[model samples]
Structures are given as structure tokens and as C-alpha cells.
Target chain A: MIRDITIGQYLPGNSVLHRLDARMKAVLTFFFIIVIFLCKNFWSLGLMIAFTLLFTAISKVPLRMMLKSLKPIFVILIFTAVLNIFYTDGGRELFGFWKLSVTDKGLYTAGFMVIRIICLITGSSLLTYTTTPTLLTDAIERLLSPLKVFKIQVNTLAMMMTLALRFIPTLIEETDRIMNAQKARGADLESGGFIKRAKALIPILIPLFVSAFRRAYELAFAMECRCYRGGEGRTRMKQMKLKARDLGAAFLVAALFCGVFFLNYRFKALI
Target chain B: MNENIIEFNNVSFAYDSEIVNAPAVVKNVTLSIKRGSFVAVLGHNGSGKSTLAKLCNAILVPQTGKVTVNGMDTADNGLTFDIRRTVGMVFQNPDNQIVATVVEDDVAFGPENLGVEPKEIRRRVDEALKSVGMYDYRLFEPHKLSGGQKQRVAIAGITAMQTECIVLDEPTAMLDPRGRLEVMETVKRLNRELGITVVFITHFMNEATQADRVLVMDDGGIILDGTPKEVFSHKEIIIDAGLDLPAAAEFSDMLISDGFNLPDGILTAEECIEAIYAEAKKRGVC
Candidate 1:
């Protein structure tokens, strides 16, 4: 059960999308999301879907992974479909059964909504799947650097995010170790009542809490010994750079956004 | 070499709640360790050897006594940082002790803590990694490295700090056999080749054989203190304290009692083989 939990999943690749500046990718993703929502009719939506598929292809992320991500949201899709099918009111009524009615408008609304949602998820997942977590946090910090005006301590925040991302795997491993150790001691974690289940968790929690505090203490001591007083005058080995391709990709995204938004508006007018 | 680089004067430490059903961990322990030497502290589990190592660097101060490193009192708040800088510690778990994801970064961490200039930090990191034979792993993520490699990186972290002495608390306890050998070799090289003072804490008697001196503790008391040969000679006392001898040592002991002309105090396979061959030659059997 513990092995199945994938934290901050990052798949390494040498694809063009992976090579782009993280900050640009993050910003482009925002603009891309807006484009998806603005696209309404089939022509504009078709254009956006083509664009998403193109990026997805370039990223080299498998289609199966995208599908797996949507697995959890299948319930949401079904719920929305059901709600729209019987409750939606409009367009020529197709059938009537006991107080429930199915309309042509309901069928169309449900179909478009599900498709839109699936595209939205599949499109944004590209950013996370292709980019490393460290790079993603680095991009976030660089993009939010303007908040330094409010004394945000951007480097500290980014460092925290990077460390947090780095430690997620470590903590998961530790949690597994603690759970196994407790189990070896005959502490039942499964097949127990509500109160018993809670009681069983204490053995795992105590050691984990102790270990966490111990790690923090060691880290603090280590930092102090290194004279690390918090990111002042610190230079990075890998300086974040913005390449020509990064800007080119952002511009391409912007152009797509403008084209889709206007085309959708025109398509809505025709309908 | 100075006979006393570290002097603990009339030291006694009870746990904070010692008066209330709490046992004292180190009781009235007073000793001095020589400078420019490799010393191994031997004890069974819960023998207070770890607590003593902690005191050497001011990680824990004595409740009733004083520890002085090169004449500087460790308990003095003004000198605590200096004392720590003087004596670095490598812990049991190499996985947790490493501060950076990358090997070089982890090695550089200790130097960085010293507020060294960036250029010096780079130089020290490279030198330390090279000394530990991990220069090639500089770019590797620490978690991907094997147990021995991670421990070596942790040692490099302490080495880069340029501490005069290193105190390792069971550095090989979690390691496999090969990992244990690699770490022990590295520890010896740092001590003998680099002339750095080494205080190794371990339950492995074979590891203790590599050191210049051995200090054995039993039940919060100093049971035996001498060179390896002198200490291991009191074999009965150590075993009585519930610590087993290294395999080679045990084999040598059995052979000795069986009147096989084998020499005493064999600690490693190489040593045992050398002694057995010499005996064969003496008996004209080989």
C-alpha cells in the first residue's frame, strides 16, 4: 500500500518541452489554461486539443500516464454527466420517464463538459510530468520574485520548497520503515475497530516523530557548522538561464491563446 | 605526540532524572587521549561509549566534571563552537547524516558551515572527496549511492570541515561486510596517512584492531584501556562483559588452546593465514 504512493512524480526526459526554462513553462501553462477555458465551439476547441497533443508528443510523456491521472476523476466525470443528463433543462426534449427528462441540450452539455475537463487535466499534467520538482520550484520562485518587494525572501521560500520536494520520498520511506517495525512488534494496523486503529497508529507515530525531530536537530547543527545563516550572498552552481527557445515557446503559446479566444467568440456568435 | 590532547577531569554524568530511578551513564570517568593517535572505543550496546564521544565535542556537557580539548574547556559557551570545529562527529546512520543530495554538496556542506570563501569551499570539497576516494561520485545523488559510499561522503563532510579530530559513533553498524571494510580502511587512512586524530566507537573487535589504542567500556565504567594486543589479551574479561571476539580472534584462541603452534592475537584473515603458514614452516609440514 505504501509503495503505491508516488509523491511529486517527475519523469526524466530530453524532450524539447523538458529543455524549456521552468519559469517560462510555468507562465505558459497559465496562459495555456486560459486558452482552454476560452475555447468554446468545436473549431477552437479542436485547435486547442491539437496544440495540447503537440506539446504532449514533444514532451514524450506516455498517454497511459495521462489516462491514469484521470482515473481518480472518473467519478467526478460520471457525477457531472448524470447531473447534466436528467437535471439539465433546454433544447428539444428527447424522452420523458416518470418526472425525469432527457433533452438534446443535456446530452451536448455533458459531452462538452467531460471533454473539456479531460483536456484540461491532460494538458496541465504536461508541466509536472516533464519538469523536475526542483526545477518546478525554482521556476515558481523566479516567477514570484516580484513579490520580493513585499519582503517575501524568495530564495528561502524556494529553498524550502526544494527541500520539501526532496524529502517527500525520504519521509515516505521512513513511514514505511516505522510501520513495518511496528507490525513486527505485533501492532495491528489493519482489521481493527476505529478506536483500535487509532491506538495502533501511536507506535508508528512516536518513533517517526522522534526521528523527525532528530533529523531537524542534526540539520540545524549541520547548517550552523557551515555558517548557513539563510541565503545571503549564496551563489548557485547551476544558474537559471532563459534560452531563445524558452521565449519562442512562450510567444507561440501567446499566439495560440489569442487565436483560440477570438475563434471561440466568433464560433459562439454563429451558434 | 602529546600524551594528552583530550583530558577529562573527574567527569561524572547521570541522566537528568538520575536521582529518580534513573541510571548514571558515565560515572566518575576520568581519562586522557593522546594526540596524533587512532583510538577505538569499544563497548556493548548501551555502554555509554556514545555519550562519552558526544561529550568530547561538547554535544553533551558533563554534569559533574570537565572536558578540555587542547586546553580549551568544552563547557565554556564562548568556546563551544570552536570546540565543535576542532572535533567533528560522524554518526551511525550515513543515510541520515548526509546533509546534501549530491555527494560533493554533502562534502562541501561542512566547509560551507565554517563560512569559508566560495573558492576555498570548492577546493576543500574536492580535496576531501578525493581523500575519501569519492571524487568520481561528486555529481551522483547521495541516495543512489551504496551504504559504504554514503558513509564515505559523510566522512568527507567532516574532513572538509578541517577538524583536528573526528569522532565516529558506530559508523559501520548499518553497513554490509564490504561497506564495513571500506569505512574501516578509510578511517585508518585518515588517521595514519592524514595524521588526523580518530576516535572510533564500535562493537566490532576486528575494527578495534586497526586502531592505535583501544578503550573498552562495560556498564558505564572503563573496564579495560590499552593497546589492542594488551586489551584483547584480557579476552575473558571482555567476553564476560558480553562482547564477542572477532571471528579470526576466536579461531586463533581455539587453535592456541589446542596446542597448534599458532601465534596469539590474530585479528584478520590475513594475520591468521600468516601465523598458520609460519607454524607450518616451523613444523616442516609445508
Candidate 2:
């Protein structure tokens, strides 16, 4: 049951998307999100959808996995689409009953919104699906290095993130062990009601927290023994370098932005 | 250069030194570890062995006396980094010591902290992992490895720093028998091939028999310090310190007491077997 979590799910591969520099991939993902929001009319939305599909195909992440990423947001999608169909105004009315009405414009807007959201999700998921979490954090640290000018400890924050990511699986396994130990000791964690279950978790959480603190103390000592003195003179082993592929990706994203702007200007607003 | 990689000059430490009379965990200990020697410290729980390991790298400065690593005083804050660089430490808990998800990244952590160039770090990381027999596991996540494998990775992390001496505080205590053997073999190889000094702190008597020297600690003081055979020969001191002699030594001692001819200071099963066979042949019994 604990293994169902798909957060930070990265599929390893040697595909083009996987080989792209993580920093550039992150920047491109941000630009893709903005372009998706700027999309207007069927032409712009279609372009965005095509861009997402191409990215997914190049990423080599299975199509089933891409659709699985959307499963968790199914409720939100249905809720938003239903609201858009029932409440949106403009264009010719399609049907009406007792002050509730649906119009062609409403249908158009619902379809556009759903497609826009799907494109946005897929574009960002492609980035994570290709880049490992370690590389992603490295990219973030480099991207945010400028913040160091404000006297902020960007390196320290990034180190904390890296440590946290490294320990997630370890801590999850610890939690599983603790839970089973508790169960063996006659702790009824599963059959309880909502409040009872939460209360029952107190036993597990207290021990978990204690062990986590112990781990942190030991890790700090280990790090110090390795001559870790903050990030002053630290050099990274995996250095991020932008290659020709990054430039090509940047150009393609620029073209995507321009296409969306042209489509928005050429077509009338749907909602 | 001094022959000693680490020297403890009457060092004593207390976690809470502010109290009027806090008991020192390490009590007036004066010792020197020779360069490139494998020394195993044997002590039961609360025997200050862990505190001594911490002092090797300046993780815990001596409150009363002085501790030096490679001629640098551990108490001096300016020399702490250099001291730690010369003497790396591997703690008991492997899970807590590993700081990276991927094995190679974790191995590179020590060199990265020392500001080694990216190219050098990569080369050293590969070399260290290969030396520990973990080169193939470099790209593997640490969590997926066995307990013994994780401990080896932790050792590789220290090796990448190219430290002259390594102080491990019960690194194999949490491991199973197989895991303990794996760690011991890896440590032995590092010491034998790379000439890395090892100050292994453990309670397992058999593990200590493999070391060139052994120090038995009790009540925060060294009870015996000599070659493994000499130390194990003092059976009373070992038993009084809440410890046990290695199985081979104990069996040999029992045989000697039962009117059988057996050699003294037998520390390995093979040695005991050979002695017993010699005795039997002398008597024409087999």
C-alpha cells in the first residue's frame, strides 16, 4: 500500500528528452505552461496539444504512464468542465430547462479548458518523467544561485532539499517497519474509524519522529567527518552544461510562443 | 613526520561539562595509533569507544586533554577541516551516514566537500567504489542495497577523500553475520592494499582477532593494549570487562584446563584445530 505513491516518478532512458540539460528542460517547461495559458481558440489549443504529444513521444515514457498521471486529477477535470458547460455565456444557446442553459460557446470553452489543463499537466510531467530528482534539484540550485546576492543561503536550502529527497525512500521503509511492529504489538491501525485511525497513528508517529531526529544527528556528524563546512568551497560532480540540443529546444519553445500569440490574435475569444 | 596517525594525550570528554562534576565518557586516555596499522578497539556498551572514534576526526573535541590527528590539534578550530580530511569516520548506522540516493553520488560527497575538481572527484569515486567491490552498484540507489553493501558504500565515501586513517564505530554491529563478514573483508582489503590506517571499534571478539593489534576498554580506560594474541591471553581481564574471548581462544583455554596439550593465545578456529591435531599426533591417538 505504501508503494502506490508516484510522486517524483522518473523513468530512466536515453531518449532526446532525457538527454536534454535539466536546467533547460525546467525553463522550457515553465515557458510551455505560460504558452498553454495563452492559448485561445481551437487552433492555439490544438498547437499546444500537439506540442505536448510530441514531447511525450520523444520522452519515450509509456503512453499508459502519461494517462496514469492524469488519473488523480480526474475529479477536478470533471468538476471544472461541468461548471464551464452549465455557467458559461455567449454564442447560440443549445438547450435550456428551468433557468439552466447550455450553449455552443459553453461547449467550446469546456473543451478548450480541459485540453489546456491536460496539455499543461503533460508538458510538466514530461520534464519529471525524464529528469531524475537529483538532477532536478541540481538544476534548481543553479537556477536559483542568483538569489545568493540577497545573502540568502541558497546552497544550504538546496542541500536540505537534496537530503530530503535522498531519505524519502529510506524513511518510507522505516515507516513500514514501524507500522508492522506496531501491528505486531496489537495496535489496531486499520480497523479504526477516521478519528480512531488518526489517534492510533500517534504511536507510530512518535517513534518515527524520534528515529528521524536520531538519523539527522548521525547524518550531521557523518557529514562533518567528511569535511563538510557549509557550501563555501563545494564543487559538484555532475556539472550541468548546455549543449546544442538545449539551444534547439529553446528555439522550438520560442516558435511555440510565437504560434500561440498569432493564433490568439487571428481568432475571436470563445469565453 | 610522526609515526602515529592519531595521538590522544590524556584526553577526556563529557557531554555536559558545565556541571560541577560530570563523569567523563573518555577518561584520561593516552594512546597513539601507528600509521597504516589495523587496530581494533574492543569494548562493551558505554565503554567510550564511540567517543574515541569521534575524537579521531575532531567531531568531539577533548574537554580536558588534547587530541591530534596527523600532528594537527583537534581542539584548534582552524585545523578541524584538515584534521577531518586526514582522518575520516564511518558511523555505526549506515542509513544515517549515506547522504545521497545514488551510490556514486554518495561516494563523491566527501571529495565534493573538499572542493576537488569534477574530473578528479569522478576518478576517485570510481576508484574507491571499485576498491570496495561496489563499482557495479555505483549507479544503484543506496536503499536497494543490502545492509553490508550500504556499509561498504559508506567506506567508499571515506576512501574517495583519500584519508590516511579511518575510524569506524561499530560499523558491523547492525549487520548480520554475512554483512559483518563483507564489511570486515572490504576494510581489510583497503588497509592491506591502500595502506589505510584502520581504527575499528567493535564488540565482536572474532572481528578483533583479524586486526594486527587490539585494545580492550572498560570504565573509559584501556584495560589491555597489545597484539591480538597477547590481549586475548588475558582472559580474566576480558571477562571482567563484560566481554568474551573469541570462540577459538575460549575452546583452547578449556582444552588446556582439561589436561590436554594446546598452544596458548589461539585466536582462530584453524589455529585451534591445528594445535589439537598436533596434540593428538603426539599421543598417537589419530
Which candidate leads in DockQ? Answer: 2
- Report the CAPRI category for model 1: incorrect
Q: Once superposed on the true structure, which residue ranges of model 1 sit more than 4 Å away at CA?
A: A1-6, A40-44, A81-112, A137-238, A261-271, B1-10, B17-23, B27-36, B68-73, B76-86, B99-146, B160-162, B192-195, B219-226, B233-268
DockQ, candidate 2, comes to 0.75
lDDT (Cα, tens digit) per residue for candidate 1, span A11-65: 7789999899888888888888878777677788788888888888888989898
Per-residue CA lDDT of model 2 for A106-132, tens digit only, reads 888898888888888888889889999
| Model 2: lDDT to the true structure | 0.92
**lDDT score of residue A193 within candidate 1:** 91
lDDT of 1 at A85: 82
User: What would the TM-scores of all predictions be?
Assistant: 0.79, 0.96
